[model samples]
Target chain A: MVQLDDLDRAILKLLKQDARLTISELAERLNRPESTIHFRIKKLIEKGVIDRYTIILGEPLKPKSVVAVYIETEIPVIEDFLEKYINHITKTLSMLPNVLAVARSGRNGIIALIGGETEEQIEKFVDDTIRTLPSLRKVEVFPFTNIVKGEDVIGFLVDV
Target chain B: MVQLDDLDRAILKLLKQDARLTISELAERLNRPESTIHFRIKKLIEKGVIDRYTIILGEPLKPKSVVAVYIETEIPVIEDFLEKYINHITKTLSMLPNVLAVARSGRNGIIALIGGETEEQIEKFVDDTIRTLPSLRKVEVFPFTNIVKGEDVIGFLVDV
Candidate 1:
């Protein structure tokens, strides 16, 4: 674990909120000297604490509806076939623009975040694109009706 | 829907990769004048396509294990009670640092992304903190063994 003082945490919190803040602005807000703020940020980057800077695209570009789908593939007779099948499914989903995120969940399961213009549209895509895939044991869809925390994630993960 | 020309999308894509890029750099890369790059970025910000600049924390700060949990509450005799219960559950979970994200799945269901140092630790958290809650109909945990796309999201959403 990395050790972080209160100042480091404060700077990280501020930068996470708005990375556009200049060193002088951060100094003024945190009551630290400009040099200290700059040094701290540099150290944070060097330590790999601050991974990267990026932009979150806002509404109109963000999907109006999002759903989390859990797909469980049937265990094939050949063990090698199951591993290959899971890899193929994840790669295929990752290439699609509508599939915002994809991950392998345990041995025979995959979880994906899918986005669309409407609930109906997303459901149709799930039924047509996902449910149609062969050798799947079950597919469950969880629609995000209201995001209470980390709501900006959709904006962060959406494709431009 | 917001209209985005090829240039706007290209600019957005580059910025999304690295928001710290200077206007001159963007211009040089895109074969456009610096003034044009500057103008386009300004317009993009003004139009709210670029929501905000942010940072993604690296490995040490990010959780080593992550799981997506779906919690469904049992419906009560009073609809009002169910509404308030769901709200209360979401609010409580949102306040926890380990609960990376929380969203209402439906009238009586909640979807939360949880993080911890290990899978066992996260399971303990779910067993102790979440499953203990009264009136839950079901609790499902999906472990993300491998994230194939949009994996940086964990870094983006993880709290300091």
Candidate 2:
């Protein structure tokens, strides 16, 4: 269990905003020696504090992160929807091969967000899957056109 | 903006799992002295990397972070939805206060995951407002009972 001191908390907060800062730069900014900064970072990794680094890959590109969207079905459908359905849906969407995350939906119907390299591919994925899911009475598919606050921004950092 | 070095990222990753770690304890675990660890943390703070410290508040007792929810509406509705409607929506949900984030559904609706204090508040918010919005035809609401992978966990040293 890691109990964050103010400094640790601060370091985390900064990175939450931007994740590419250098140690010497951080050291200079912190008025500390480069060695001190470097070692502190090394410690953080050994403790499993930092996870892996990732790149945000969309710029009018292959659809987006929510390649696989979840169509929300009403509560009445939960009985029909099962864990097996997840793998099944993933495989089903695999036909299109572009969708990313497919969970359940929130409201009345099963929702699936299409993700693909081209507009044509995305359209086909939605069409094929619409016929596949039987329990689905009405399917409302929404393609992501733009990003507001992405899934990546949601964090749990503590300020110093 | 917070830029994370390898260490800062590690610290964030570890803390997400367990936030009760002590300075010296972290130092020992990470193989650095407490002082150096302390310095980087300080820099992180001054840089505004860390946001704020908050308790998870437990899933069983507290309102969990909301995940799956899709609001199905019409896109032409966004023009009006963005005006008095969207701002009010943001204000109302923000007032209810548990909602972590809200996104435009891309289609006609807004998709969001709400972390409500109680089920009643969430249900009431949707039900009461449903009929009021003329453009909103079928407002489907789903309360998230489980989390696939915590969005907060992917975050690093800053509060990610």
Give the winner by TM-score: 1
Q: Write the per-residue lDDT of candidate 1 for residues A102-155, one digit (tens) a residue.
A: 999999999999999999999999999999999999999999999999999999
- Tell me each candidate's RMSD, in Å, in order: 0.7, 10.8
Instruction: Give the number of the best model, judged by DockQ.
Output: 1
Q: For model 1, how does the per-residue alpha-carbon lDDT over B12-119 read when each residue is reduced to its tens digit? A: 999889989989999999999999999988988888899999999999899999999999999999999999999999999999999999999979999999999999
- lDDT agreement of model 2 with the native: 0.48
Structural similarity to truth (TM-score) of each candidate? 0.99, 0.52
**lDDT at B76, model 1:** 93
DockQ, all models: 0.91, 0.10
TM-score of chain A of 1: 0.99
